[model samples]
Target chain A: MIGRLNHVAIAVPDLQAAAAQYQTTLGATVGPPQDEPDHGVTVVFIELPNTKIELLYPLGDDSPIRGFLDKNPSGGIHHMCFEVDDIIAARDHMKTQGARVLGTGEPKIGAHGKPVLFLHPKDFNGCLIELEQI
Target chain B: MIGRLNHVAIAVPDLQAAAAQYQTTLGATVGPPQDEPDHGVTVVFIELPNTKIELLYPLGDDSPIRGFLDKNPSGGIHHMCFEVDDIIAARDHMKTQGARVLGTGEPKIGAHGKPVLFLHPKDFNGCLIELEQI
Candidate 1:
């Protein structure tokens, strides 16, 4: 079962502007950008009292968020991550429920250095979901 | 300054099906749907540990979500709500910073029975932001 709402990832064309908007305009605490080569993206975290908002920008040529930004030029909510106790169990449960896992159905090290798996957006009312083991 | 993340709103085509997906598939505690006539939305609250997820469905002929669902038939993330201590101050700050507010730039009673204002998605990297006074 999903425990906590980990973070909402937003793929942005301009990461700095997005981060600044939250920091100066919204007056939230925004962290510096961190590049994750494995994930092919750069992330800037906007910390809130309860949850976090991750501003994702394409890092490498094959960055996963690049294609997303291509379609959503301005930027858009890429995915919503939820924390789970056991990712293996969660993946298995999702499988039994006919929910499609994005990548090889295995958990990968996410940007936060945690095992995470993405569920198909089609199966979740067109909303991409990431299950992270915490 | 923004306080807690009030909730994340996801517009779904089929309200009951979305609720069932979260309740049974994800094993989340989902509340009964509440029809907000003023907002033209029927919302189902999916309670999480840190925050909540609101599943929105069109409730009236002039439902605002209808346009979004028309574009994204499968439904999608609608908006993210953040709580602020003073709505008026937040609005003035946003205006002074050149961030456009939606509607008449006035706080309206949101579904949660609190004063809420929606910020222009264009100013926030294509992500609709709702600020609620808490």
Candidate 2:
């Protein structure tokens, strides 16, 4: 079952510039940055009052983040993540429901090194859903 | 600065069927139905732990929700909303940053009789953001 939302991820062309814009607009602070080499992206979390916002930027040409940036050049909202108790179970459950899983076949470490799995947006009516084990 | 995210609103063609599918998949309970005549949408909110998801269907051809549903026929994600302390201030602040505002000039009663305003998706990089004053 899905738990609470962990954060909403946004793909940006320039992480630092995007963070500065959000800080000025939303009155929030960005957390320390982390790099996920396997995903080929570096991300930072902006702690909001009730939910955190993640900013993602590509580290390489083939970066999945780069693809998202290319698709959404204006650098808007990316995906919404829900915290789950067990990622493996959630991934299986979603797959049973006919969802296409991205990333490793098994759950992999995400931006804060948390185990996470992504259900294809095509499965959820175009909304990219992320499940992360807390 | 902000209350919890009241709900993430998704524009769908069939609210009843969407609610049913979500219940079967997520084990959630959809709340009582409500209508916002001004916006021309009949909405049903599915209450989830820590957040609520709203399913919106249009009542009229000119319904703003209809526009969304038309643009996203595959029934994709619509908007993310955050509960705010002051809708007027938030709207003005966003406008100061050059965001175009939708809906009435002032916050008006929305689904469940709560005051709400929408920040243009164009301003936010294709992500429609709603602010509901709770």
Candidate 3:
């Protein structure tokens, strides 16, 4: 089951501008941008009191975020992450119940250096859901 | 500044079916459905350990969610809600920084009986953000 609301991700055309908006306008602490080669995206974290906001920009043409942005030129909410105490159990449970996990259907090292799995949006009511082990 | 993440709203074509997925498959605690005529949507809350997930369905033809669902028949994330210590201060600060607050630029009573204001997605990296005074 889902634990904490880890972070909500937004795909942005300009990562720096998005980070600046959160830092200057919202007065939030923004972290350095990191390129996730495996995910093919560059990401920055905007720290909040209770959770974080992740700003993502496509790193390469193969980046899935690029496809999302191509469909929505203005960018949009990309996906939401929820923490889980045991991600393996959660994935197994979801799979047994007919949920489709993206990629190889196995956990992959995420931007946070934790094992994460992405659930298909079709199975999750059109919202892409990411599960990360804490 | 944003406090704790309140809830992530998802527009669903069928509220009951969506709630059932969370309840039966995900094993989340689902709340009773409530109709918000002011927003022209019916909503249900799925309680999580750290935050809640709101399922929204069109209450009438005028419901804004109708348009979203018409484009995404499968349903998807509508918006995200973050708790703010002072709604008015946050609104003023956001406005001063050139962030457009949706509607009349004033907080309205949301489904949780809290004063909430929506920010324009275009100003926030294409993510529709809702700030609630908590």
On TM-score, the leading prediction is 1
TM-score of each: 0.99, 0.86, 0.94
Rank by DockQ, descending? 1, 3, 2
Real contacts recovered, all predictions: 0.85, 0.38, 0.73
Ranking by lDDT: 1, 3, 2
- Give the top-scoring candidate (DockQ): 1
lDDT of 3 by residue, A1-134 (tens): 77777898999988888889888877788999999988899999988777888999999779989889988877898899989889999999989989999989989888889999999999989989999999
lDDT of each: 0.94, 0.74, 0.89
Itemize residue pairs with steric clashes in candidate 1: none
Query: Whose lDDT is greatest here?
Result: 1
Off by over 4 Å in 2: none
Show where candidate 1 strays beyond 4 Å: none
The ten-residue window of minimal lDDT in model 3 chain A covers A45-54
Q: How high is the TM-score of chain A in each model?
A: 0.98, 0.87, 0.94
Superior by TM-score: candidate 2 or candidate 3? 3
